[model samples]
Target: MTGDHAARPGMAAPRLALAGWVLFDWAAQPFFSLVQTFGYAPYFVRVMVGDPVAGQAYWGYGTAVAALLIAVLSPTLGAIVDQMGRRKLWIGATGAIYALCCVLLWFCRPGEPGAIVMALAAVCVAAVAIEIAVMVNNAMLPGLVDRSHVGRLSGLGAALGNVGGVVATLLVLTLFVANPGTGKTLLGIAPILGLDGAHQEGARAIGPFSALWFGCFILPLLLFTPDARPIRTGTPTIRAGLSALRASLRELPRHPALLRFLIANMIYTDGLVALFAMGGIFASSILGWTAIQVGLFGMLVTTAGIAGALAGGSLVDRIGARAVVLLTLGLLMAALAGTLSLGPDHVGPWAVAPPRPDRVLFDSAAERVYLAIGTLIGLCSGALLASTRIVLIGLAPPDRLTQFFGLFALSGRVTAFLGPLSVAVATQLMASQRAGIAVLMVFFAVGMALLATVKTR
Candidate 1:
């Protein structure tokens, strides 16, 4: 009836094991931070696709596909892994695929035949692999530390992930990803390694950079972290895994708090995912920011995320995960409203900052407002994500931890496509990126309402 690990309930894992486990987040984050959100995605939309509107739609569709795949497979894999045990092997297998896919992205050069298709395929596969790997990693959490320390560990991991993101973004901006107009990086120097800004080779290098970062950082976890023992010797059979999954599904309704929390997570995580997926593209298309500018903004957001996650983790034990979630959600809604209100010339129809031909980076009032709003969004989002994980740990049965973590991934990803797809559809219908992004507000509001009904102890 206990979580599947050698560590007894309430016993702390060894410090080495704990450090290794926490470092996995640092290892895994660059893929999301650089490739998915800040660096490669914006490049894909802006330069490779060459029309912001069409590119956003295309990117959305691709993200939807990845989310749908994650939704369908995560729970099933969780069940299978629960039967097979030893999460490290699964993590290694998926991490290899994820890393390889990222490296392959270097081939997706603009104007190359089939480059677009190749890029989309690589991204979609990598996304799915990483999400599955993350599910397995999350399953390891309940076993890592005592219940009392769960929130702190989870929050610390998220904070480290943001730190990784910030470092990775900075690296890309400094070493590669030059401003096309000036042929310079953020540091006023040409991109190192002869990376041509005109050919966008610098931007394309984000893929390989992320891959290298992941490969290097993941080794600590594999080398030092202890994995759960196998439930039984040898490979687990598909039939047995299916039976276990069915049993878990049938038993779900008995835990009303867990179910409600999952549902709420399902709704809100979609909004969060969509927001992350679109944020860079929105900046490029709506704000007319260049890749370097977007990367800088990403650094700002990620720096804020680190602070928020650390604070949230600290508050979880004191205020409770539920309170942290609620507070962060409220903050997220307000920040999102502020985000949707701003444009190049105006903030919520005031027309305050007109276009200045002589303007430098982030000089206008509108841009400044956006930077402030984005900081808040970053803070609230990091807290929201970490708190939600703690909420799941609080609500799930100790015995069924891995199976439920799978369900947790399912809940987070099941309707994930709807978030991106709705944004794509709304953007197409309204021909306005702002209108499309505004759709996420509804997801946040509905999730808050649903979360309120769950009675967390």
Candidate 2:
């Protein structure tokens, strides 16, 4: 399709319709924001499993499983969706599965005999479904309009998603999650629906809330975004897609720079994922933070992340994605160091006599230190993600950009399990969540070193 197709007056998709397309991100981020990062994830560690270290390991395993499925299936699914030409069908179907899995999370009560295992399975399935749906949603991008508005549209979409995360964090904090000691929200009231905060029902409620949030916000995309009419349709589409995917894999080795960058990204992005995945549990376990504190902290981090993404977008065009990736990775390394230095008994690696919670928000030296360092992690996470795609695009030949982008996604997925599994194994072996989290630094450092030598042009 010509770039001008979406920009011309007659051909352009309606503005409100386009806005709805961007709303996809706004609709989807609460899963990561509340369920995965801040709310229910911690509840798993603190309550469900009743052991922080074991809970971290179990959580990592779930993520690892999901990443494995995504890596194995995403490329083939993308190819099939392209052949089918009806992205909405896949998006709707996949989305329903994700929502159902999330709603089922309400069953993850602390004392239920199989609740933790069941929750893990639901999470794995839901995460895989979300990734697949996102793949289908992205595949529909070109057909929805044209290239002229793509960058701006994408930026708006991402910003809205980050903002959604912030809002979700705030809502979950004020409405559902209660302080560990007081069993009250920041609003100083009982959880909505009288959820038993004493038994952590309030915390576990993120599952159902995430489901409702996803379902309500995604209506615009389903109603407004246009789907491509299938060229081949159904069974034949899958067969053709498998054949095309096989050929594409055979073609990848000729593009060495793209290959290297993908490998580097695979290593680093997995590490980044692992860190954020463990962030909530780590805070709860080591810092003695309540659900309310974690929620408040998440609100702050998502806000910082949005600022970083905006800043990084400007910088990537000016300084090249390679430089941006290097700079962001460096910031993360430093942040990781700062994060590692903090423990309940210490501030910046200096161990002290048992310091108890005191004063106001982040009153203790350890909490203060962690907050400062964690802000840097938040800043780098969003920025690096924004920059990496541009870097990949810059490395690919214009004629083969689509194939290269697919390979890029494949690279990210192929070893996505490594970081989480490593964390899981490390945590289990050493019985330390910190040790597991610290392993991510190795990946970031390695990726930076690999990225330094890749040719961008």
Candidate 3:
């Protein structure tokens, strides 16, 4: 893989490899979307674990474990990849770990003894492996095409992933989650393909479904993507790689811009991830959203995300990554304000007259306004994060792409525990979901201030 390939017109194999790489996201997002975001997390805390507050604590801790593990290993792996030049191998192995673990999610069930612990381990391990895979895959960016094309490819990949999420969410909503009160699926018929409603299998089945989706779609890049040329003399190669990794770690403080960008990203990205990871659970617990409602909301946000990613990617080239990111953060502040301001009835900051409590699903005008603000926030978040990838690619020194990207992933994931932990702590302290969400604004504001000084060019 080399940036030189961008000069050549119409390379079918590389295109296929790119598609295969993007498909990895398509394969992977279902776990994050359906299981973590929409269905399983809430199901785990509410039904499986039989407690919402304890569930939030457990969920936050599980994510913290993964983040800490990834933070420890990702940078070293990145440095080793740059030294050994075996990015593809690392990607393949880690991706396999992620896929298989996702499939194992099927075993988690309500009332199963030790199921929560086992599933949390699986989830954490899978999360760590997925981050490692991303570290390698993203390192491939500078080698895939010219600087001009990186944003577009990244955006396209994100858009495709969102599409995948939308499709998967819709399928699960239509097939698996039955409305307990109405006794009807989202599609207004019995769940398709004769899903057994007797055991509440719809929610459990997402694990295997995600596994299958990931496994089937991830093959092309393994076959078609070019692997880095191997270095000779195995023992010497390993020794040298270790030395190089050590050097990269030792050298980190010297690179101020890159270092600052990473630190800022670490803070903001953690908050972003925490918000999404816990959003559905909060809604289900507080707003009384069902699985069907969760699925529908996931689809809506995902659609907005895709649109934002495309727009952000293009805008990054014109307005610069710094501007795009700061703007996004500002929007996030407003969105959080709107979301938190809404009481049991009204929406958007404050209201002299709150709506009747009986109205639901953005039924009140204020609730509708809050949802609109939230949708905008989601859109900007998707775009800003996607653009951040391009910025990282541009800022990383040419020869150490993998090592730098590893640090990038590490920084993003390492502090991820803090946001959720804070949320968990705040939720417990206040006994309100809104208060927990309000805590995230501090992270966003501080990160934005730190990022404002970064030199994008």
Candidate 4:
């Protein structure tokens, strides 16, 4: 478990497995973007469920439930993986679970009894499984290359993921999402070989699409990724992992900087999650955008995310993690406040004529403005998250990665409820989704202030 263990002879093969690992994020994000956040969630509420309030509440519960499961299981599984020293096995198994759940989403037909419940369960299972996969993938980091390359490598993974998100969004927009006016896709074709707008089938197809995307892209990693040298057969890695967990928690006071970083990450990450998850919902409701508009917006953000992640990685290497995190967080605070301040018809608290939705992409001034702000937020989030991971790598004890990252995952999940819960509460109280959105800035502000005190070195 020494730092040298990560650099053992066979590790070279797994570093080439980076494509597969990065693709996992790419494959997974569309579900998060199109299905969970922008397209399906709102479509379910506004179109399928026929009640925005109910949809919002159900969505919040689903998210809360997913985070809860991840919180409970992330640490234990992380410890087990570390003890067993087979990160690839766990990654493969969890990837399958996530893909299957994504495929099952196609069955959640509109107006069906218990449809929302079923969909939420699929998402919850997928959420936990995906987190497990990420922890395993992350554990491979220190072993992949020299310490000098970790930040760049992490940034590259995130950037690849954004590219994948953009590609998926484009495909969905071309194949399924349509203009209500022309009833045509971005290609001006009839939604990929006659899949029409009838029955809202295009929207329904995203579930299976995401599943297939994940399944196909992960093959390279499974085939090419290297495995750790197996320990003696009689050793129970799971039991050892558990013991390690207890020891780590008792020992955390010795790593005060790591503890402080985790606390700050927990808060800011929650806020970031809340913002991205709800932005599409808010835009659709307030701006009266269709599925196509949402898709276009998503593509823009995805492109921005790629750029931001790469930039953040470079910045981390140059200025260090603390600078990158604080700078990005500051940008996040401004973006949140800016987004909340503007209405579809207004800019900077001034009201004007709302743009017509029927026009092409960026045709309306208001739409253009919204997309610009959305890109800014996306950029900062991408950079912040990628840089944060680098920071975690720097702070973790070399031998006990799973135990520490498990605690890291726990911090993310333990308070994940706060942001979504606040959104739900604010939506009801203020009679405006804007009020709920405005609540997110509180977490970012507090997280930044706390983060400033943590020492990376």
Candidate 5:
């Protein structure tokens, strides 16, 4: 469990350990892709709140609260990791928080007093816990691979995560969430678990299902991945953790490149967060897509994401992390603008002269165009996140990798609430979801400008 053991490049065990580490990404994504982004989240907006526009605004407001808390705590915990010389223990602790919150999502009900508030609370807790777990997991990266290969491994993790998302979303769409009209799954079969469509169990099951999936998949990492040896600091672990964090904060001014990268990450990562958090709601409200159609959309997006992560990783090894990030951000900006332009029957001034209101599920030309635009978002999002981590790793001092990675979360969270909160405010002000979503463009544009100034290795 020492640093040397963590760095050792053994033949058989390292491969297995890497696989186990990657499996973590796989196990963790369903909370996001299925439960958070594409599945249960939409249910909250449509069924729980009962008004798409207001639901979206409130959802964003709740997410902002969670993001603010996570932003404040992630770096503190990371600083502790550097002192403790351990990652897995913190990961387990946070993983428990995440999985429990997810399982508790089952308690969400329709029309009860404070039902919406309780659901938002579960979402807030789950979001915070998952984010903490992710940062802790990233801190473990240096233990898994050499510096030269970090980009590829990061890319592989992103790709595998998307693969897991695709599978999880598909399973829920086909097995658990029955079609709203027909009360049958995508397979045209009766809902499994005798899912009470009356009480919306079919959709609600996504919570416990995601919890089970995460617990099962994280085992590979817990069982096989290497951990740093226990260090014997003279002070308590909490005291040492605080001192380490304080010292890192004081020394940050000496690192201009790292400083710039964090600023850029804070802006753009917020934009990315807003995109995923609200994408499903956008589709459900504007496109009128049910869980089945939404699941299909998730599959397509995740599949594209897998390709984007791999391609971005290859480019990171050749061109540079900075270049990859800039490219991805540009694509994301364009994709989002296109998405914002389209509504049910209109596309930013180009109206479908003959609007097909009679048709079901993405029947309009604008809807089809929106679907096409989502593919671009899917492709760029995976690459944007994968390469951003590589950029931070390159800029950070090797001795302080975990501490710096924690700052990465801090960077993302610092303004994380701002993006969604602004969207919430905008949606409320304009009374239009499209205009509210358009606010993300400001984050991306500012982020790209800051990213351009960083010097690459």
Candidate 6:
């Protein structure tokens, strides 16, 4: 009811509260890691749709729809939450919707009537709900700890998120998903729940699995994290919130530094999101990977992410978040270039590492090279994501934290549709996944250039 027990500025929060706050990231990550990036997406493209190109395009359009919705609603909702002043309630509401949508994904079976539509709808709604929950949770950060520990906490959250993703991916691979060839899980046994691998039921289980994980893990925050008291309620809150949002929009241009950072964040975050969305599709389509291979790849990348976030978090405190952001952006650009250069039989123009008829898991030199590149991408992505949040927290005004975080979500989502839509259109037109993903390079490059202009303390 009241935030009287919450940590004030210049004071440390209770360790319990900090842990609960950090665990929210842990709670949310399996949806991203398993459903979005590694497990269900690849299965959807390879098995459900049965055509990589069409599936990729469909996935892109679905993601674009989600991004557009988030773009339109996040800022307004953030402003309203600021007026209402109770973030945990909003987080709980959105999280419940997110979990329910995720559960619905279990019903999306191949060849079933309306299956693809159901899948896309569930993904879009879940994405929007989780994204809004994340924005609200992020706003709570400034209130939970003093300025000195913000970067550290941000980094810790990211690292823990990666850890959660890795663990979830492992669980899905070992217990649920089975290899089509052997019809056995990674542990060399039948899927525990009688999941039919032949029908791709194991892969579909990611939805309910993620939902269960979210429900179980999010409890700490609800129980332990302090929430600010409501300042207004009902129709009056809505009216005042709308008026406040209008004022914030008008005054935004006056805060040039925050504006610049938001734009830069917008661009780069688009690139990051597109990369994650497309990465598994690229692997499954180009390299002829299956569920097991993609899951292993997810584990590798997420482990690297854990290392990167932890290191970046510590580095941000010493070298400054801006420097860490710049460094990671450069690294990500290089990784993207490396990723684009790779093919099944060759790295770039040279046709080396030709396909081996008896090839085992990722046996080709090119595949090994790609794995390395993906690890680099994962590392840089973790650092980049954490540092950007630190940068925003550093720049945003203290009183308008939630509103600014809403703007943060808006900026990230506004052009977010463009990233995936461009990829979808390019892939559709060029008939090449490579050409589509290449568009992300422009976003990272332009974002880096714009980021150079922002001043941070």
For this target, which candidate reaches the highest lDDT against the unseen true structure?
Answer: 6
Query: lDDT of model 6 at residue 104?
Result: 91
RMSD (CA, Å), candidate 2 to true, equals 2.9
**How does model 3 score by TM-score?**
0.85
**lDDT tens readout by residue for model 1, 1-457:** 2233546777887887788788888988988888888889999998899988788888888998999998888877877887778898899999999999999999898988999889999999999999998888888888878877986897688678778888888988988999888788888888999999767688899988888888888887777766788876444456677787788778889998899889999898899999999998998887888898899989998888877777887899899999999888888888888888888888997988664655688888888888898899888887787678888888888787766876776788788988898888888788778888899999999999999998876
In model 3, pairs of residues that clash are: none
What candidate 3 gets wrong by more than 4 Å, as runs, is 1-14, 83-89, 142-148, 192-199, 232-239, 249-252, 255-257, 314-319, 348-367, 389-406, 455-457
Cα error, residue 176 of model 2, in Å, equals 0.9
Model 4 is weakest, by summed lDDT over 10 consecutive residues, at 1-10
- Largest TM-score belongs to which candidate? 2
> Candidate 4, after superposition: displacement of residue 262 in Å?
1.7
Q: Can you tell me which runs of candidate 6 are displaced by over 4 Å? A: 1-15, 313-324, 354-358, 389-406, 453-457
lDDT, residue 238, model 6: 81
lDDT of 3 by residue, 1-457 (tens): 3322222333333677677667767877887898778877877777777667778767877877787787777766665675567677787788788878877877877788899998889889988888788777776666666666876676677677788989988888887777655556777666555665544567777777777787777677666665555554356766776787667667788788888889999999988988888877776665556677777877878888877877887898898878888999999888888777665454544553444434344555554564576578679888887778767877788788767866676778667778888887887777666777888999999999998878865
TM-score of 6: 0.91
lDDT of 2 at 88: 74
Error of 5 at 340 (Å): 1.9
Ranking by lDDT: 6, 1, 2, 5, 4, 3
* lDDT of each residue in 1-457, candidate 6, tens digit only: 2233457778877787888899999999999999988999999888878889999999999998999898888877877887788889889999999999999988888888888989989999999999999988988888888877886898788778878898889999999999887788889899888998767688999999999999999988888888876788888888887888787678789789999999899888988899999999999898888798899999998888777776787899999999899888888888888888888888988888765655688888888988998899888887887678789888988787766766776788787888888889888998888888888888889999999998887
What are the runs in model 4 whose C-alpha is more than 4 Å off?
1-7, 14-18, 142-152, 229-236, 317-320, 389-410
How much RMSD separates candidate 6 from the native structure?
A: 2.8
User: On TM-score, who's better, 1 or 4?
Assistant: 1
- For model 1, the superposed segments whose C-alpha errors exceed 4 Å read 1-16, 142-151, 231-236, 313-320, 354-358, 390-406
**What TM-score does each of the candidates earn?**
0.90, 0.95, 0.85, 0.88, 0.90, 0.91
Indicate the TM-score of model 2. Answer: 0.95
Count of clashing residue pairs in every prediction: 0, 0, 0, 0, 1, 0
1 versus 2: better TM-score goes to: 2
Which has the better lDDT: candidate 2, or candidate 5? Answer: 2
